[model samples]
Target chain A: MHFGIISTGPISAEFSQAIKFTDGADISAVFSRNAESAQAFIDQQQLQATAFDSVEALCASNDVDAVYIASPNSLHLSHALVAIQAGKHVVIEKPAVWNPAQWDQVWGAAEKHKVLVFEAARHIYEPAQKIVRDYLVGKKPKTVRLNFSQYSSRWDAVEAGEEPNIFSLKTGGGALVDLGVYPIYDAIYWFGEPDGVRYFPALAPTGVDGAGTLVLVYKDFNVIITIAKNAHSDAPSEILLGRETLRLSSVQGIDLVTEYTAGDEQVLFDSKATPGSRPLSELMRFEAEFFCDMIQAHLEGNFDEARVNRYRSLTLLSRSVNEVCTNARYTAGIFFENETLEISG
Target chain B: MHFGIISTGPISAEFSQAIKFTDGADISAVFSRNAESAQAFIDQQQLQATAFDSVEALCASNDVDAVYIASPNSLHLSHALVAIQAGKHVVIEKPAVWNPAQWDQVWGAAEKHKVLVFEAARHIYEPAQKIVRDYLVGKKPKTVRLNFSQYSSRWDAVEAGEEPNIFSLKTGGGALVDLGVYPIYDAIYWFGEPDGVRYFPALAPTGVDGAGTLVLVYKDFNVIITIAKNAHSDAPSEILLGRETLRLSSVQGIDLVTEYTAGDEQVLFDSKATPGSRPLSELMRFEAEFFCDMIQAHLEGNFDEARVNRYRSLTLLSRSVNEVCTNARYTAGIFFENETLEISG
Candidate 1:
């Protein structure tokens, strides 16, 4: 599987490096607004891929099997539509679109073109996530809390009255969308779509949530998703698995999943996950491996009914997640550029 | 101070044991519905207190200087009122009353009698609590979360369709009153009264809250109080003191108060609060020490202006805390016996 990495941003560089850990998957092309930045990222990553100045040319390249969209939050729809229309499968960034309007447009094009579109929610593909998912099969917990509050590196920039790309409304970047997406996805993935969603954002000076609490109400129990970009807390996220408890060290990137019984502490995940832990770049390998296998099965006409259903459910899950995040942020009085959709919190 | 302990409940027994740790404080009298039960408790604790079946007889005993009201939730007001009216200082248990109306009645009587009325919110008087309080001076946190959840021992009884006193509406007992009081008091004790409060209760089969989430809205930040009695979680309570984070091992009884900086993990509390750690019985010693000092100062008329102000502030704080808890519970669709004054959540 060949991935044409879009944008020369930090995440794009990660995707470029992520291919190293996967089997026979390579970056065939790279795209950037400036040719120099694209070339530089390629050179830094020691990639054999061609660097394209225009996104159109990158999508049009014959060698590219799929285009990995690592663009900003607002540009996800435009970027993916172009790649899908160019007869390429697309692996989009975590949140695929800003609102349902864009969501409908992107999926419509993907369906029309008969191409796959995957949201690169990295943690969902990790082996650790599978352990939790398997443990939650019949014995579902009533109470759950997923926290992914990391003090943003760009928070200093926002504090200095500068709109770092992540802290800007135009870029569709805020704590809820950028950092909240992980826990938001985790909530939906593990416990289905909440019956209702309410967000309490710690709004920033640049009109974005610096940190916030999300009350996602399920039928019986409530899920509290704490997300932040301007503050940090070491509090473990919790899930009460019947009588016992599963304490996840983190929601974003977990290394420790501790389950306590009447006895001592039982560490669920077998491995240390990584020796020194995989570099940030290699962390994206799991998502790449998943997307490549699914897309390749379709290309080779070897996709079974089970594989088809799996891919379909994943796309639908991404669809629901985008709705929850968009609606939650909008309800909390956080609107992207020109977005005025009023969904009650 | 010679104290008459009301009721022969488990808390009353613990109070009798806790007095052993206090200076010149002992159970001068014991009250129970049955004289055998009162006499049995006195024998078990090896106390020289007189056992009284009649509540009036216990309160009217000349040997008792103050009464520790450890009665059932519904009986708290009646028991405390008897003690207060008898010219004895009172130490009522946590969540003393269910509604603001009850709060008004209890305080009104306490003021008229000119006696010290303490809530016996044990954690507030702990040496560790003072450490967190002193550290919070001038450097308040932006996002705070206090969690104290322990699966109740009586949960099996509730599951068996039998209403234990802790799970009964008539007894003025539920998760919010039973377990939620600790975190609620912690919120008010550290941060002042929240501007607004909203509660989302996970109601039990017996129409009482088995567990719940309390959203306490402060001026610049929101404090989340996650409490449960039907389940357990080891998730640490957090207080983001400025840039550094303070992780409390447990809000109910903290053994670890960790503060993290740019360098290494800094354990905040200098000494281990206890060597082998105090028993649950001895945990009540702090509250006994506090109430006894205030009451003893008043009895000798050696109560200086500072002592007067300290006692005044404590009662005022308790007054605010009661209002917050009662209002929060009422708003969350929980109304105790014959009380339904709606405050929307």
Candidate 2:
């Protein structure tokens, strides 16, 4: 499978690097408004890929079978539509689109074109997720407390009067959309949509949430998702299933899962190559490979039983995650119906 | 201050035992519908006090200058009013009344009779509370997460077809009114009344909250209080004031407080008599002394500056704590305005 890169961002580079680990997937084209950056990315990565000055050019490329949409969040709808119209399977980064209307538009185009669209929420594909699902099969979860807070390295730049897109309100940026989506997706994936949602966000000076707590009210239990980009939390994230508990030392990548039951703990899944030896970048590679494998399986019309049973399909999973994120954002009072965009250069 | 006991419950015994540590407060009279149990209570502790067969008899005793109403929750309002009408100061157990109307009646009678009323929320009087207050002096707290969950020993009795008053719905018993009140009072003490409240409770078979999460929404932040009688949580409760965090190992008594700042932690207060060597019950004694001192000061008309600065008079603090608890309970759908009593014998 030949993949077309969307923007020349750090995530795009990571995706390109991770695709190399896959058997049949390769980056065939790169798209960037600045042609020089696109060319430089290909050269630095030593890839036999063409650089396109426009998204239209990349979408028109016959050599590319799929497109990886790593563009700014606000551009997901427009970019995904371009690839779908061109009959290319697309993989969009986390938070595929801002709200339900945008989600419907993107998925509508994908269905009409008969092309696959995947939201790159790598945690859903991690092996630890399977362990969590299996452990919670018979028992009912009473409460889930998820915290994904890390002081952003880009915050210094923002504090120095630079507009980093991740912290910008105009770019569909906020702690909830950028980071909170992980836990929200986990809740939806595990427990479906909540009966109600209440969000209490600490808005940044730029009118975006710097931190927030989201409550997902279910019939039997409540899921509390706390996310922040202004500070760090050393506490582990956990899901309480009555007398049993599933915990992750960190939610950033869900690299490991530990289950506690009846005063004893067992390590369910440790993504670390060795105990406490895995680097952060290795987890990103796993996410990249998962997305490529998913796209490949979708194209082959062979949705293997294992993959289908775990995540249904890319289209359904993306739609469900996007719906939950949109509803949560609305409840948090961060996203509005008519949001204006001021994308930074 | 000579005190009259309202009931022979375990809490009344705990209160009596701890009051011996105070300088001028003593139990002078005991009341119970069953004269034998009240007499047994005095004899068990070898007290010099007299046991009365009726609440009126104890309240009418000239030897009793104050009353400690440790009866079941449903009886607090009636018993406290009796003492107030008899011109005696009263110290009611935590959650002094069911709702705002009952609270107003008790406070109004106390004000009219010129008698002091105290709610025995011991943690509020602990030195740990002062440390938390001082740490949050100039900082704006972004979120406060409090958990005070303990698996109740009475749950087994309830499951075994026993109607223990603590889990009985008729006696105004449930986790929220009994355990959730601690965190609610903590929120009110630190952040005052919130702008809005949303509660999601898991109701027990008895139709009262077994566990629940309460969200107190402020203009800038939200306080999430989690309380349970159905289970236990080893997770420490926390208050986030930007980069600084104040944590309690447990909110049950807030025996110790730890402050985290800039990747380092310092113990702010440790209630242990010797370093790291205090039993849990010793902390409860600190709470008992606090109430006794406040009552003593009110009677002497010498509100020392330190006591006044730490906690305003018992009247103002009790009113505030009761108001917050009532509002929170109403939001949780546990406390209804038209609730009827079904006190067990």
Candidate 3:
């Protein structure tokens, strides 16, 4: 399948390289707001691909069969909607969008255009994540803790007051939006939408969350999700599945998986998956292929609404985290640019 | 200086070896209720030391100069007071006694005898701990989380009710008495006594805390401590100073120390502590040498009253955690062997 790459950033470069190595996919085109950045990406990869300066032009291009959206969290709705309208299957990156309104807008457009929309959260596709889900198959998971905190170089810029990008409220950036989404996705995916959630955030200067902790009280198990953009801990990015714990030592970019029993030091099982370097990017490619598969399955009258419902569940989870993050900012006395949010039930 | 080792347990054996390695200390005698156990330790170590079958005989023995009390938590007071009455300096293991009344008795006896009393908490003697203390010389630490939860084999035995030991409330075994003491000590040592504390315990069937969360609210910052006996988490035993955090990988055993700026992942300093060939037993040796150092200093009329006062502070902390754990058990509708703990302060 031919895939269109979006937002020619460092991450996009990694995806393009992974696509070059993948067995069945081709990076057919590149899209960026700046024509030079797109051309630079094409030249760097030395690929026979056209560069489109706008999302509309990229969606209208004949060379692409599906579009991969790696733009900022705020731009996901606009890019996904444009691609769906152009009859292109969609693969959107995390935080899916800034809020549920954008999620609904993108999903509605994808349904009307008969295109598949897959969130490119490679963690969900990784083997470690599968092991976690497998471990919690039948047991009642009573607690979940997901922690992803990486000290970023961009934090230096934020501290120096170089107009904040996605890590600032103006750009829909905060610890919850940027780092908290991983645990949020894990909670909703593993357990289902929580009946309710209590969010507490520690605010940073310049109207963004420096760090935040969310406690999602399920009927049985409670989930604690910690997201931080400013601090570092030795805590691995892990999913605690009540009876056992599924650990990815380097949750930041891990292809390996290990399971630890409730009280044992010895890991029960370990699968150091041979995902050929750049596993995270390969997950992006797999998501793209899955989108094409879902689209074909839908058109041939063999659609699995049950599976589609899972995808819709992803939409709901993505929107829920964005809601929590936005609301946390409001509660922390941080004034965001998008103040007119429609509070949803 | 000469030393008496009370209890022929694993910790005492290790401490005996440590005294042999110390500069000015000798393992003058050993004691246990069972003469066979005391003889076994002497035979195994090839130490030319007198062995006694009871604390009274050991305290009366002229060969002993000081006593290192490594017996179970419940036996600390009786054994330490016996040694003190016989004019022997005493070093008691952590969670020194079952309650504060016992601690007061031991303290009064030591003062009357004009003998030094030491608590064998080895971390305070470690260079890393001194560095951390020096690093925060003038700063009022906002939060201090000291976690020392090792999934002990005794937990399984306690749950089975076979030979219930310290992990059973009937035997003074619980997360608070066993593991919670570390965080309590850290809070007192770093931020002095907290204004208030909130404890959430997962009680065992024996009405002891298996694992739980603790929130210590100080004047400036809130400290969070978690100690679990039934489950394992990769939480570094830590003290989060206002300006930085000092993290140790394990409680009872700290082989490495890392320092991070407050609320940041960038490690300002990390001493990837080199692990020696001898496993956890080496800490006992360090404790022995430090105990002798204090003894000699005291006998030489250079005793530091501040060190003894710090131990008094730790006693107060242990009392507070005891109160909270006892009350939390009641809230969970669990009754233990000693449920009439007066927690009202």
At residue B133, candidate 2 shows an lDDT of: 76
Ordered by DockQ, highest first, the candidates read 1, 2, 3
lDDT of 2 by residue, A206-245 (tens): 6677778888888878888877777656566777654456
Q: lDDT for every model?
A: 0.82, 0.77, 0.66
Give me the displacement of residue B38 in model 2, in angstroms. Answer: 2.7
- Give the least accurate 10-residue stretch of model 1 chain B, judged by summed lDDT: B270-279
Best by TM-score: 1
Residue pairs with colliding backbones in model 2 are none
Find the candidate with the highest lDDT and give its number: 1
Q: What is the C-alpha lDDT profile of model 1 across B1-345, one tens digit per residue?
A: 899988898888888888888897888899989999999999999998999998889889999989888787898888888888888888898878776677778888988998778888898887789889988888746677777677887988887899988898878888778887888888888888999888877778888888778888877678888888888876778876435788887776667788884345888774366422556676788888888888888888888899989887887788888888887877877877677532332
What DockQ does predicted model 3 obtain? Answer: 0.11
Candidate 2, residue B55: the lDDT equals 92
Index of the highest-DockQ prediction: 1
The better candidate by DockQ, 2 or 3, is 2
TM-score of the A chain in candidate 1: the value is: 0.94
Which of 1 and 3 is ahead in DockQ? Answer: 1
Q: Would you list the rank order by lDDT, best first?
A: 1, 2, 3
Task: Assess the local accuracy of residue A75 in candidate 1 as a C-alpha lDDT between 0 and 100.
Answer: 82
